[model samples]
Target: MLETSARLLRLLSLLQTRPEWSGPELAERLDVSVRTVRRDVDKLRGLDYPVEVDLGPTGGYRLGAGAALPPLLLDDEEAVAVAVTLQTAAGSGGVGVAGLGEAAVRALVKLERILPSRLRRRVAAVPVSTVMPLRAMPTVDPTALVAVGAACRDRRVLDLDYTAHDGTVTRRRVEPHHLVSWGRRWYLLAHDLGRDDWRTLRLDRLRPRVGPDGLATGPRFVAREVPGGDPAAYVASKVADVRAAFRCRVRVAAPPDVVRERLWTDQARVDDLGDGTSRLHLAADHVDGAVIMLVGLGLEFVVESPDELGEALRALATRCRKAANGTSGGRVGAPAELG
Candidate 1:
């Protein structure tokens, strides 16, 4: 009886490994009678496993889908990959996905406990999983995020009030399509009703509310493809809109590589001026931030466009001039404290 039970388990494992297997093929592999194979398959079906069967001369049996989660049979490599991925996901904050990560780890531990000694060592050799280091950005309510995500997957439309960078409040109706996560920020790619165009919006900025519940039933919207499928374009566009307020530019006297690496490595567009100098064009709505960036780099640069950058530099130079001359009126030092 015990031997028969073990053979039944091996047969079950084999059936799960493939989509279809003929009665004779399974019987030949298991060295059992074809009648016994049929009996075992019926036993699996009784256990709530959907073992599908075909009749006639080309008769075969296979495993089919069931309502609830079925037991999964994973080979060595497959098992190891699941364990590693779950460990990584635990730290990745996305709505409540962190909880899924935790569950994955617990499940992996259970699987490892039953794994053979060889398999256990292989899974253990994988370094103890650690969360990746990443800057924290804004986080959204998990339930709300999941609800909206479900809508997107179903191709639904949404009505939301989003706070603009200028603090101006506006309500918009949008056809939500895709949710993209870059670095620490989340973006929603949707079509705006009022604007009649596709827009990429910050998920954090959206004041999402329960709406009139509708799908994007008009037409199947195609997602816009950014150049080079660049992941940075969406964030770059957001930054550009904010920077447009301060129309300024600067030329830094340094090699292209050096200037690019130092000042404005992420933001500035560098044009090689040749002869060890590069033109660094910076555009910012707020001069203070731009000024701080340039001065902080401690690089020799010339303000080239908008002239506002030059004006800012002059203002800083004047402050130094006043501080050096204690008379406070372009006169020689006269501070009693300094003397």
Candidate 2:
């Protein structure tokens, strides 16, 4: 009886390793007869596992979706990976999804409870900590995320109502290709049918069109190659264009390569001037923010455009001089008394 049970578990594990398995292949792996494989498959079916049979010349079996989720079998490596990922999600205040942290905690508890002592030790050895930002990030609807993810996987078209930053709402029909998770936000990289262009849309701003049946996903689409053949790079460029309010130029006393290494590729563009200096084009929401970034670079720079940026730099320098001379709180050039 124990041997049969062990074989059944092994069979289930083998089936999960891939989408489909031939009867002869399974028999060879188990060192059992084809008849025994069929009998075991029947037993698994009796236990409510949806084992589907393919009755073609190349006969095979596959696991199908059932009403309820079956217990999953995981190898040692997969078990550790899942435990670590769950720990991260649990620590991260939910990754921009409402109630995700609590859900991750619940799932982690269940997984850890069933984990072997060796695996538990492995999971516990890794520590995870998350520091939340002061600003509130937009949260995505879990249902909408799931619907869009399913559409991406199934190559289906999605009709969505999207809210722009200016509070304008417009309906869009898109063929979603991928979901890109950046920081605490989720973005969809899709081809816009109406505009005849590719668009990176925020998941929070999207409302999937629903019919009486459920999420109204349309016909499957032939997937297109992403712009530049890289989805992440394309999305990053699009996000930078949308978020940057001030495109300020500066001449920095550094080589182009050095400046590029110090700044994020999406945040700044550096061009070599061939005289030990480089031109830096960066985007920021405000001139003060640009001033802070340039000062933090630890290199000498001259603001080239946006006279307001130069004014901000002058203002910052004056404030710093006042603070340094202990005259910021009192009268000009007055030394502060030691407490």
Candidate 3:
């Protein structure tokens, strides 16, 4: 009886991993007769597992879809993979899918309880943490998420009411294309009929209404692969008038690799100048962030056009001189900046 239970478990694991397994293949793997394999398959079916048998020269036994979710049988590597993914999602802020992270943790706890000693240690060693910046106090209804997702999937037009970051609200009609999640934020890529252009919408701010039939839904927006699918650059472009107000162009006397590593999210562009130097072009909303970043790079750089940035740095230098002469608060020549 113990041997039968073990074999049944082994068979269950195999079925879950692969789409189909012939009766002879299962018999060979289990070191049992074809009749024994058939019996075991029956036992699995009796436990409410929908094991479908295909009768043909090329046919085999397959684990078919059931009406409800079934208990998954996972192996060592699969278990570890699941545990690690659960830990990550649980910590990726409460934006993408609400309560998903918490549910994952709960499920992981139950799974860990049944894990062997080595597996348990591995799962426990993986740490999870959430760093949600600027809490987006918008609740996304599950029904709206589902409805819009379906529209995007099936190619449908949707009427939506969206509130901008500055609290200005407007109603828009659009053709849904794709949904993008980037660093605790969700954006819906869609074709705007009113403006006749593609626009990205914040999912949290959307009040989606089902549109009538006959309105054409656009063709799928072919996505260009991006590292991590993060649209940070695109979002930053729409930041504020100040972003376009001043452009800070600086040539760093350092290797391109070093400059790339030092450049932060605010930078508009970074290019290798060759000959062990790099050029950085960035929008400066606040002169302080730009000047501080340049100083932080610790590399010699020439400030090109948009002399306002240079003026800001000069003003900061004057302040430092004043502090050196005991004029400003904090230590002398410290520039009154974060170390």
Task: Give the better candidate number (1 or 3) by TM-score.
Answer: 3
- What would the per-residue lDDT of candidate 1 be over residues 1-339, giving only the tens digit for each residue? 998888878888888777679998999999999999999988888888888898857558977657775677777788778766655555453322324555665776787677889877776687754554323346655545654575576455676778886878899887777676544456777778799876777777876666343222333345545434654555444443443556566777788778655653234566787788877666654776678778877788777776666777787777667778753664455542210
Report per-prediction Cα RMSD to one decimal. 10.5, 5.7, 8.2
- Candidate 2: lDDT of 164? 96
The parts of candidate 3 lying over 4 Å away from their true place are: 1-82, 89-92, 95-111, 114-121, 124-158, 165-168, 173-175, 210-247, 252-285, 292-301, 311-339
Clash list (residue pairs), candidate 1: 246-284, 246-285, 251-302
For candidate 1, the lDDT comes to 0.66
**Mind giving the per-residue lDDT tens digits that candidate 2 earns over 153-201?**
7688999999998999999999999999864688999999999999999
TM-score of each: 0.44, 0.74, 0.52
Comparing 1 with 2 on lDDT, the higher-scoring candidate is 2
Query: Which number leads on lDDT?
Result: 2
The 10-residue segment with the lowest total lDDT in model 3: 235-244
Total backbone clashes of candidate 1, pairs 3 or more residues apart or in separate chains: 3
Candidate 3 on 1-339: residue-level lDDT in tens?
Answer: 999999998888888777678999999999999999999999999999888898978678877667665678887888998988877776764356666657777887888788899997887787766666433444455556766786675566777889886778999988776676544456677768799876777787887765343223443353444324544545433322222545678888987678756654433566678788877777654676678778878889999866777887888888768768877765644545431
Candidates by lDDT, descending order: 2, 3, 1
Rank order (by TM-score, best first): 2, 3, 1
